[model samples]
Target: MEIITSGRLKNTIKYLRALFIIGLILSIFFMLGILGVLAYAKSQGAPPLAVPQTSLFYASDGSIIEESHRGQKRYWVPLSEMSPTIIDATISIEDRNFYRHNGFDYKRIAGAAIADIKAMAKVQGASTITQQYARNLFLEHDKTWSRKITEALYTVRLEINYSKKEILEGYLNTIYYGHGAYGIEAASKYYFGKSANELSLAESSMLAGIPKGPSRYSPYENLEKAKSRQKIILNSMVSNGYITKKEAEEVYQTNLAFFKSEDLGRERIAPYFQDAVKKELLTQTNIDEKTIEMGGLRVYTTLDPKLQKVAEEQVAKNVNPDSEIQLGFVAMDQYTGEVKALIGGRNYEESPFNRVTQAERQPGSTFKPFLYYAALENGFTPSTELRSEVTTFLYDDGNSKYTPHNFNNYYANGTITLAQALALSDNVFAVKTHVFIGENSLVNMAKKLGVTSDLVNVPSLALGTSTVRVIDMVNAYGVIGNGGQKITPVFIKKVVDHKGDVIYEAEQSKEQVLDPNLAFVTTHMMTGIFDAKLNDYTRVTGQTITNSLTRQYAGKTGSTKTDSWMIGYSPQLVAGIWTGYDRDERITLTAEKQYAKKIWADFMEEAHTGRNVTAFKPTEGVIGVYVNPDNGKLATNACPISRLTYYVKGTEPTEYCMDHVDHYEEVEEKQPEEDPDKDKGWFKKIFDWF
Candidate 1:
């Protein structure tokens, strides 16, 4: 019996020894496999840890205008700024053992692995706070073995590089909270219109329940589902001892007030200006779209909030609310080209099309100034006379014939000066002047003044037939307002990075595109529109637009069958207003409803309230001369009527009035030999002594 027992014991010992050897070999292989994975992770390099940040836009007065973001809206806040309730609730639900684990929960991972193996797919996620942070920062939320391995690798890096508080903070800030919100602060403000530090226990639990399935648990989307998740979170908080059972019960029963979904839509202020800034940033800088959206840039813009408010209010008050007629308003600094105020449409919520910079409509008579300016530059004075009779322009080898006349077919048939032609907005005179200077010259002049739209070089262009944008028209008129210095409109003044360093600063660009004398002469002619007793069509019909603002300003009124424009400027401010329908339909202006002029006058009057009235300065080489109103020539006392007209020194009419030769025949002509100063005028001789 003893020998049999010994044989059994020997067999048991042999089996035990063989089992020990096999276990040792398996352990060695596992260790080597882990070592290989660690080495591979080390060689693969660390994942990107830079967090996406929200960018802010500010007005000139340093007031926040808007906040912009890319794929996810995140407002990073330090852990101290977070309420203890939110931190506790998040920890209770996401990772109760977060403080004790190195980087992951191995027990939970094992359980999850077993469950996933049984299901033959990933059925559960055992990611701790640190692991989730790693995934949110660097990895994607994809369920795959390769993705899991990558997430695990990043998890170790995060724990090693950051502290426990930092890991928790990052996890809370980077987690998705739906509704375009990604962080605790953004979610708090989005859901409750308050800060995270002010969240109550109920609110914290409700917010904490969103990270698991934001869309499914969002109160805005599904109240019952969100309430159910909130209950689960409250129960977890109670189990973890973060809150008492009674407290949890009371908090769950507490009525939670939520922010309206429309509040998010209202967050965007001045949507049109915001869109313009975004486009300009992308086009003018080396920064890419992704960088601008997510790089946490602080953009200081040139928008004047006060002026913008006045513009919006004035437009709403003046335009017909029920009519489909749309209005485009743009105001800017004439010299610097800083856009002070802009209103692209009546209601940005209903329509997002920016008419200020996008829509192209004919300027009608408003374009006459550009033609006359071109003529002035090419040796024509303000007193240059042209016949205002009906004229036919044959273009394209006579394939097209354009018969031009004044507005309402009001023909002046006789001769008219350039100033009268512009004041009357005579199409026939404009066509004659356009033909005299050639079509390409006028187009080039408009281009230099900042008209970028397509301009057909036709005779009708003299009557503002070419389509142009309101912004371009405003900038173009600014050339005349700014004393001939070309200025391009600028929206963003500077762009700063998250570190408070200026990445981009606007350099004011100015070009001497036109002679200062020619600009002054053109401005002087434009002032004729305000002359109430000038007997022109605008005045004779009592459409005298500028009678409201009795200040010394220059402007022009334009109209087409479908569009109405009133663009004017003082020495300090330049504003343009356009009223028209989105579709090309006729807009009949009534006696009381002069939409464009009223809006322009209202906005300009408000804009110039506290500002000084500075007169347009005339440059050197320009002299004021009293000329015959009947015929554009040097006026004498014998002439029935005469007015002070400005002209370039050499371009003024040299000859005396010949139409009234009978009246002037009594006075002998002074020969050059008899009078040494015969060529100079009486005013010129008086100035020569000085």
Candidate 2:
């Protein structure tokens, strides 16, 4: 009885032990299934993809300047819009069994395991598109067995949770192709300068092959390796029924039709203007520098390519090519104040300094217009005149006196009109006018014209003694061009984000800075300055043309020792030309009008070839009546000589030259010709006598 009981106990122990082993195996499998379910849920809902922001620029004509961003980036494209070649090539090269496998390819895994064991002796890696996305989106860039296992697990979960097409689309949008490229759309523009749908089979194959290793297979860096990779891709395409074998061979034989990394067209257009626009973009959008250079973006600008070309050619031709002296130019739309053409420096590579906004030089007589405007605003008219004579200033230090002279170094010998003084750029007349009106008025007027630099409130401010930038000067002139409204100079019209969303729209704020009548009066005075109306007293050769030979325009000439400036506006365009040394050295010993005016004329002639010749109408409160040179009043036959001056209504001279009765009579200019070979104007002879 005892032996039978012991046998039963031994049998029970064996059965219990067997049950324990079976349950352990079952529990292990069940835990794995639950983990798999959780992983699958996580993969199906991988965190939303991260995308970098890109900024784009546009011109006045609504053209792109620069797109700001950096990345081997993708632009989101719908499946319907994606090219069949692109879709097929990507699938063939990345994952042949992409459609058949759940995200994790077990067959590939087994093969890769054997390959890895063989490669562990060396080095090897095989990753499917889903696995790559899993790594790119969630995993670190670590090549560890643990990481590999996680990648496989996530890839499988991705397949279970997402559709084949959905996974493919997400992968395409999220993959990094080397050269800072991201998506198919971005890659298309970066490589081909077109949309992804427009990519050719050869182009698609080249792009498709980039996934193996973008840097290694980049056509730009290693064309031969890229071709080899392309061939492998082509074979896969052929085997997968994506393309015919003959077609693949033909494509393989053809030279890689790689583009010049996009923008072949932009290069052929306004490169300098485009560069300026980009600089403005850097300031407007706080994008990272690396992204701007590597991230492909489409920039639109406000430049007129045709005008930009003309402006460039004119500057290159007129300015000394080898001279380090920089020139800054800006052309704007009269109505909108959009900067159309700009040249920042002689060469961007040599000197990155932008003279347009950076350098501040005296506007010289250019400042007189603002003084005149102030006079007009404070109750003056185009017919108003100020006494043009020898005037000396009394300073706090009585011993130190200030006496201003005209360019010709002679007082008008008697009273002269304001129109004549401006046309002649007479320093004496302008200084007197500023004194009468008060210096602060001139400063305020200048500020109204967009002068941001400090203004020396001394008497010399009337002669453009304060420094101002070329851009500011041009913008001030634009006030007259646009009647009386002040339009802020706009280089960037709009900025768009990478998603084609408008991030910043241009706000071209314009406000009335001067009375319309005053602006007109100022323009009217400038017109005669260029019309040779003061020819008897001054030589205004550069802007002066025969009425029959002339196209209607308005302009002003300025000289301040080292610099010479000529700025003008036709009905169609406003342009300015400045000539000076970069070191502030005098370009010529003597201030000459010819150099600046010639450059201005040459540039304007070419710029306005196809454009209409427009006229500036005389605004109200301005009149074109002639005045006596010897007396500041409406001209008469009895007046031996006359000069026309424009003024605001009440500033017209109420009295003629009273202090100097014999001033005109005492003038002696009878000098025997010392050199018959020396050709001189009558005014030159007068100077020789002095």
Candidate 3:
């Protein structure tokens, strides 16, 4: 019995010594681990923290317009923007020692190791919030030793360099929460159908349970399992002192109306405009595709939702769907050069081609305004006469003889004032003016008015034979509508980067390129198209639609065999539309020919609704005069018809209409018919008295 006892004592001593050695080795390893972490943290630099996120587009009214992103559904919100409940719940469930730990929780690790040993399988995890974040950011979710060691390294570096709040924010923003949702904000929105800031305690607890096992805990997939997990989350919250035990119980019992819907899955608004903004982002910033998709840029645009809706409505209502005629429309604030509305085609979905800024169609007679403005610049008054007869113009040193015909081959066959010709849309008169002023005059004027399309130095160019973009035409019209100020269409007002920093902003400026007086006169000249008073041999081009007009608008209608264009403007807005077949098919239907004027009239009248009805205000350097439409001279009472004309301060016609004056004088000067009989004196006088 004594020998047995002695042997047992020795064995027990050996056992205790083994334990002591093991303990000492563990202590040494722990110290080395700490020192290794310190050394590694000192050596490792921070990696980029930014992840790809959605870029948001906003309208002028601060309403969300679009969301652009790559496939991932991530949105970065700062810690301040996140709800406190979410922060607390996440910390309570993810890493209780999130604030106190250097990188890992040794106590938690030991507990998990015991748990795994008791289970005889890897059934538990001991990852801290920082460890999980590091794994998510830099390593894959493999149980391999290499991945675990790498995760450990990253966690130490993160804890050493980044603040706790930043680390928590990044983890919350990037962690997957099922249903394609990444981050707490997205998950909150997905499950609760509300922003993270708006989530209730129950909703917060419900979402906090998702990141652990998305497919299993997602309310959308298995509400029972999700509710089961919610109890655990609330219990954890109670344990972490985030909530009282009773509060946790109450939250667990509360029924939640889960809204597992996503905004990213909804139909887009203003699809074409979104595309345009995206394009502008691509070219304007010159950034890579990955950045654009993930840049989280906030783009503020000049899109006026009301006006855009109206523009879309007018085009859809006016266009014939079966006719296969495509259309492009643009509306801009003439004063500010803001493109308020746009349509690339009859249907953007059918064809993605943007005719507004892409397709170049012949301007036809709408090009007359630019020519007339050029004439005004070159000392041509509104009363300047051009023969409306079909005439051939010889240019290129008389080597080029071009004979242009009027609309329907009809002409005044007599000289007509510029205003009269404009009203008639007399093509012969326009070409003649184009030739008289030199072709470069029109080209230069068009450039001044913002026509970027190629305009060749040819006589037909006068009659708008040159093809120009609808947007460019509208922009040029903005110049006239803004009283001769240089203008260009501005799509984006401001752009903010992923960090909410201003990256780009459109510069606002106006340069007066045309004499304000001449521009006013030019605008006045366009008004003739709607006036029947200026009709000579032909009715005013806008005569058919004049009854629909509510306010004074200046614009011209141009029709080629294929294309129909109406470009008009007021002080408030300038818009242009083009309607025709894609192949330039001749518009044989009468309805097709009338589309421009009708649409223009309706759009302008509706767009101008509720606004102050004011005529195009003239500058001080201009004066108005009543002139004879036929003779282009100052009008007198004897004249049967006169038009209120505008001209530069001293450019008004000096001579009065002598034809009417002379006729009136001749009638008054003629002696009475009975003068001869009266000379028979007393006898005739007595007979007359009887």
**Which regions of candidate 2 are displaced past 4 Å?**
1-82, 96-103, 114-126, 134-142, 145-195, 213-231, 238-298, 322-324, 395-400, 541-550, 589-593, 617-690
Residues 1-690 of candidate 1 have per-residue lDDT tens digits of 445688899999999999999999999999998787667766666555457778888999998788777646777677888999999999999999999998879999999999999999989989899888888886476889988877888887776666798788778777889988988988998899888999999999999999889879999889899999999999999999998999989998989999954365656667898889988999887778877788778899999999999998888787767778888899999989999999899889899999999999998888888999989878788778777777888998889999976777777778777887777777888898898988898899889989999999888988888899999999999989888897999999999875468999988755688889888989977876775434443342214555678577788888888888889888898999888889987887572237888888888888899888777777797888877755678776666667777888878887777565575554355322376688999899999889
Per-model tally of clashing residue pairs = 0, 37, 1
Give TM-scores for every candidate, taking all chains together and pairing residue i with residue i.
0.72, 0.77, 0.89
What TM-score does prediction 3 earn?
0.89
Question: Judged by TM-score, which candidate is best?
Answer: 3
Best-to-worst lDDT order: 3, 1, 2
Mind sharing the TM-score for model 2? 0.77
Question: For model 1, what is the error of residue 687's alpha carbon versus the real structure, in angstroms, after optimal superposition?
Answer: 28
**Candidates ranked, most accurate by TM-score first:** 3, 2, 1
Q: What ranges in model 1 sit over 4 Å off?
A: 1-38, 50-73, 76-128, 138-147, 160-169, 177-180, 191-268, 271-305, 345-353, 393-401, 491-508, 533-543, 589-593, 620-690
**Residues 398-449, model 3: lDDT tens digits:** 8989999877788888889988888788888888888788889999988888
**TM-score, candidate number 1:** 0.72
**Local accuracy of candidate 2 as per-residue lDDT tens digits, 98-172:** 877666677877787888797675354457788887787663878799887777666666666667777787677
Error in Å for residue 556 of model 3: 1.3
Q: Answer with 2 or 3, whichever has the higher TM-score.
A: 3
Q: After superposition, which runs of candidate 3 have C-alpha atoms over 4 Å from their true positions?
A: 1-44, 260-265, 662-690
